[model samples]
Target: MTFARHCVFDGSSVGSEEWCASLDEKDKGDWSANEAADYAKYCVF
Candidate 1:
């Protein structure tokens, strides 16, 4: 969170959607993958 704010201060382009997708791609900092997996499992019921 601190690093993200610094990156924005340093003239990096930042958007909520971009941040969300980047976090999703990394799959380390966020729980996107886990949530998706859970949803998929529930859909099978």
Candidate 2:
């Protein structure tokens, strides 16, 4: 249950919307609400 390879972190930050949306369904399914929030915070806005 690891998706670390699919993610891109800069220090304590994550990647962009294109990267977020690039995740496949299986990888995305493993995400928690907090992960989604982080993605929205860094990637969406």
Candidate 3:
């Protein structure tokens, strides 16, 4: 996903509730912000 794709998602990281909630606060935010595209590529189908 590129910046345009990320913007399409409106900055919200979509994923399993358990997985998202399991992350530490700071780590989660960073992961969501910095690696959202890569994360989605690997984590999602």
Candidate 4:
């Protein structure tokens, strides 16, 4: 949260319809394998 905000990292992918629909609070700070993949496509791609 803090790191991304300071760096201006957009989380649109993770929070988008496809990614966020599959997530819950359990997958917040500590990401599961699937979440990591989604984040990669959304935030890294």
Per-residue error at 32 for model 4, in Å? Answer: 0.5
Residues 1-45, candidate 4, lDDT per residue (tens digit)? 986674446444454654464564345778778777766676453
Clashing residue pairs in candidate 3 are: none
* Backbone clashes, each candidate: 0, 0, 0, 0
**Position 28, candidate 1: lDDT:** 58
lDDT of each: 0.50, 0.58, 0.51, 0.59
Quote the RMSD, in angstroms, for model 1: 9.9
Q: How much lDDT does candidate 1 score?
A: 0.50
Candidates by TM-score, descending order? 2, 4, 3, 1
State TM-scores per candidate: 0.28, 0.40, 0.28, 0.34
Cα displacement (Å) at residue 27, model 3: 2.5
For candidate 4, report its TM-score.
0.34
- Candidate 4: deviation at residue 28, Å? 8.4
- lDDT digits (tens) for residues 1-45 of candidate 1: 887677655442333345445545655545567555643454334
**lDDT of the structure predicted as candidate 4:** 0.59
Write candidate 3's Cα lDDT for 9-37 as tens digits. 54454454444444434365556554566
Query: Which ranges of candidate 4 are over 4 A from the true structure?
Result: 1-29
**Deviation in angstroms for 43 in model 1?**
21
